[model samples]
Target: MKPNVLLIMVDQMRADCLSILDHPVVDTPNLDQLARDGVLFENAYSATPSCVPARASVLTGMSQASTGRVGYQDKVPWNYEHTLAGEFTNADYHTQAIGKMHVYPTRNLTGFHNVVLHDGYMHYSRFKHNTKTIESQEYTDDYLNWLRGKTGQADLIDLGLDCNSSTVTRPWHLAEELHPTNWVTTESIDFLRRRDPTKPFFLNMSYVRPHPPFDPPQVFYDMYKDLELPDPSFGGWAETEDTSGEGMSPVTAKGLVPKMRLKRAQAAYYALITHIDHQIGRFLNAMQEFGVYHNTVILFASDHGELLGDHNLFRKSLPYEGSAKVPFILADPGNNLGLKENSRVDKAVEMRDIMPTLLDAADIGIPDTVDGKSVMPLCKDGEDMPWREYIHGEHAFGEKSFHYITDGKEKYIWFSQNGEEQFFDLENDPQEMTNLLKVVDYQERIEKRRNQLVKELEGREEGYSDGKSLIAGRTPKPTLRFVFE
Candidate 1:
């Protein structure tokens, strides 16, 4: 029988947060257990590190350029023909998504048979900005509506939290049962109870915690609040960052804040992760109770990594490791398919590979248009497959707009706005604190990677590449959709 596929996604979770990854503070026991049971991709990344574009790549098995979402723009129409859920649905799987789809129209479904969405306080979908008014937050989001019903409050103001701001750390205003993380897990467990059992199922439990407000349940908050947490990392090249602005949230600005303030935020962030980890444990129990634990293929990943004050950067969208790399683990049912147990694959991989990997595992044909190659063969101990030498990634963020390439061993970055270049040897400088672009000994490899990036963006209008060398000082659009000439 084809395995029931459970694709679990978390938002803005760092790749290094797992105990299995030797994270000193945070503990994700559930995820660690999953890693021990399956293959973990040590170098998984998000090509575009914001929510929408990264999700677009995950859904369509396409590159950011191919998905036409090269930046973090809301309300762009999602018109992809062969989404991951759509393909599974076509193959007769019962497809359902619970929690944060983050797709446009808020209820697009994107080929899922049904979606219970909670996109988490999007400013664009709020009342005043919503022209139709019918698609406003209260009416559009199933979670918010449920939250309102649970609280018995007509209107709630983000539960005293900011979606984009990482400055504040607080306990959840509502009960833990009503929290969005628990809601997503509860809904998914209920899905197992209600799904058509004869046919295999495809369920996406997309959690939206650990992304913002740095809010978790108070118990979780207390769990890490008193620990001797390490201070935020500061890169040597980050001395000139702006650290003095009133409205500067973590995502919008780069700078160091008070040590206590940063530590509190990190505590809450880890607390949120542990909260979700516990909820995942609950989810697994429900799966076992429903008699589906032994016949499911469980895959877990995050949309992107939070900067968490790394290099004086807070939110994602930068090309730094803290913003781009994410945890990706696939746990097969007791290595039933000859997959390696408790093994790690260090080859470069990204969100695009998810669609093909899941489809291949279910014995389905991957669409020919997908740019991602399946990594399933790599999971089998002796199976050999052609693999990518490096994965290309980029995003548009005004002056921060950048492009780069990395093969897990080295990375090359080019700022499209100012033509500034940065190179890092991951083997030596995993922290990416020291820039190696000016080192004469590394110039040859630097130019090689630069040429590779040029080849990737050669024909673009941004004048990024001029065949022989890369150019700079070109203004970048916030959103770059594919255009047909």
Candidate 2:
């Protein structure tokens, strides 16, 4: 009787925009029917791609140099011990967390039993930058105090837009039920109709609009306004060009925006990813109208990935697989675990294996200061497990601080601050557009992933690896510049 977990998350989403990851135009028919009912890790990742250190390595399953958060700092002090909804709210499960919780005293219930926040538009929770004000939206955010009690309004500045802009692309001006992705799916279908039906629930809807004021609601921006979309992934070790008009700024992260404003900002970022995939198909038909949809397990992920402009980059810290890959899926709904429906695990996983694979699929236990492991024997069938051939990833965002390591079929990176070194072969250029690190037939596979990134950055201190090499120009720090005793 343990199942029910749900966890949806999504902010700056990308992992090739799922249409089962073919994503040529982003339709996501209910996340491709939750990837045909389960298990599609196709090399997931988010080893610190952004959003507060990829949600602090997804609520502490660890890694990101053991949760000290290797970059993108904000307030710090999540003081973790164990989490993933505090170990399924310590096995009794009834946790909550609706919409975004970018952590830190914006009411830190890092172990949610309730978290109806709406961390959208956070410029460090601006109410004049912190200590919140503007009189009141109930002191800052419960989706802007329920959109000022359904728009009798007071603020949320009538969508002039700037929730971390990508410069511009519009549509949603108002009423899509005051869109914060439909107020996080109507507060997660009103917490599955006022939850607590004898425990067994974990919730956490999370979503902060494809991540940006990419706005999506003029009927999902005219349903991809005159389709044709596709052109961005360019890379011969990308530098970018063609800034046609030279006025870009909806939050410009690099350059070349102006192929009709980068196809109307990629058609308003695929109309805010099909309006958050039809508001996650109305929060999965309200979890099958409260029966918790066939026992439940679901999971879908995304704390990172959204280079929307690819190598010309734009948003996300960028080691670039469209900004550090992401889009795991899990789904169980009582297939009785052993995953399999629409299978595809291709190894490499990350974001610290999502809290020991949802606390080892609810029997719950995984804690030895978790460093992530439980992929439930790679979702069953033959079950050999023993994975992790590679996963390391990094961020720091200064001169776009870097570091990487892959194993989802080759990738090495580096770039601390111009010590540059790239080498991709993501199974024959998965749009990483070739840079076999000076290709002398891939110098012994770039000296074995640069000696596994010098044994994963040996004893860093801006030294950036010396167990055998890679010392780049250094000086990058937003955090994790070194403090581990």
Candidate 3:
């Protein structure tokens, strides 16, 4: 059963930010509808909670610890082995990657034959001389260049201020009509119009809006202003005393002052998500337009979630649900596995399972070597997966390092260097407002999980899920039943 694959990944987006998640301040009707007609995973988790590494884990079907890509600035070292796209290609599927993969070089395209990256005009922050794309001028070329060419916009190139050192004086709408979604959507649609259908394609596309700069053009930016943004996780601020890393604060903790205007930042973030949701509408429409709607599988998700001031953090890299819980939507047009729309799965799912799941969905063999289990059963109801009781993740950004494991009821976090420990009984405190690392009684549970973590890490290595046994191929093919209504 040959079918097409369209995987949509958004950067730094939170699972709870959507209206479907009962987030009152934002409107993402497009995503809302998509979730309705798709299986929503309520507890999908990141393999590791950083951008580059998290994305790499999803693509490679391995843990970030094994890939050695613990840094945001680190390249997805080719040594990790075959990526999902590469696997599909090897299996004779035509693969493409458009939008933001956030792979190093920003637009490396990695293995996908067709690559289009619409960046946030991300420059080489750590490296000065490298051009992100093969085409040097393209980074700031399209609409950004056109906007810069405009009279009023031209004078405000840098806003004559340092974005890192900016203050929250007023609600500032990021200036520009050419938002990342606009450009990304245009490129995606163009790719769709020219796509060849006979080959059965696999497009690993991504959207770069909700990632950073918390900037959106006018209409979108205004869409959420004064929308009664949710109260700031309630001094989600002071709770960071237990976390490790830099100041990681937005207040006057340093000479930088406060970087985000809480209200304004929320408004901008909501707007960016809305804009992204609209683009999703466009892609969904494209599926129907191309007559591939019933023969393709659509996956929409984020690599990891952003904190957005939860615990006073801006991005992912923390273990709180705000940072680790990512969107997991699997919409099978054929409902091959009998997955129903708007159905929510309560089981704990790690991102590592995505590779094997996709392989299984496509009738390929599941690799036993991969540490993640396939969830196609729970997705369609074959066998119970025994849902993971504890999900583990780590953050190795720069010199900062931390490890965490959570089982929905309890969470344990530890920093290696100074050996700081933090624990929370999430069932009692979902907000994780309290720390119990050094608490008694919980010691046994913490030690058990720590031992489990060590065993899991020690088993890590290179290769596909079931590489050797793939001599016979393991991705399972399910009995399918398609329904139009």
TM-score of each: 0.96, 0.35, 0.80
The model with the greatest lDDT is: 1
Which 10 successive residues of model 2 have the least lDDT summed?
128-137
- What tens-digit string does per-residue lDDT give for candidate 1 at 1-485? 68899999999999988989998999999999898889999999999999998999999999987887778888777888799999999999999999998987788989999999898878777747544676688678898888778777734355565787675677887778988899999899889889997999999999998899677999999999999987666667875546366325544446756667788888999999999999999998898899888788999999999888787678899999989999999998546767898999988899999999999999999998798878888888422666888989999999889998999889999888888889999988888988999999999999889989989888776677787777887767545645222
lDDT of 1 at 476: 75
For model 3, what is the error of residue 201's alpha carbon versus the real structure, in angstroms, after optimal superposition? 1.6
Q: Each prediction's Cα lDDT score?
A: 0.86, 0.79, 0.64
Clash totals for all candidate models: 0, 6, 9
State, as a TM-score between 0 and 1, how close model 1 is to the true structure. Answer: 0.96
Question: RMSD in angstroms, candidate 3?
Answer: 9.2
lDDT of 3 by residue, 1-485 (tens): 47787788888788888788888777788777767766778778885776667777777777655455543544323544567787788777878776666565555655677676554444443233774445454453344454455534542224332222112222224434355566666666667778766688888767776766555667777787757777546332244342343443332121211334666767777787888888788777877887877877777888888666665555566667777888888878666556766777867777787887787777776554466666777777623556667777776543335667776567776554345667777777777777765678778987776665555444233211232211111121110011001
lDDT of each residue in 1-485, candidate 2, tens digit only: 78888878888888888787677778889888877887788889898888988888788888878776788877666778788898888788899988787777667898888888877756655655454454233565777777777776646546676766664767877778777888888878888888888878888888887887787888888878899988887877677554453437667787766678778878887788888888899888878877788888888889887787776768788888877898888878668786777777888888788888888888888889988887767877523666878888988777768888898788888877887888889998887888878879889988898888888887876678778887777787766633333
Q: What is the lDDT of residue 464 in candidate 2?
A: 80
Candidate 2 lDDT score relative to the true structure: 0.79
Model 1 lowest lDDT segment of ten: 243-252
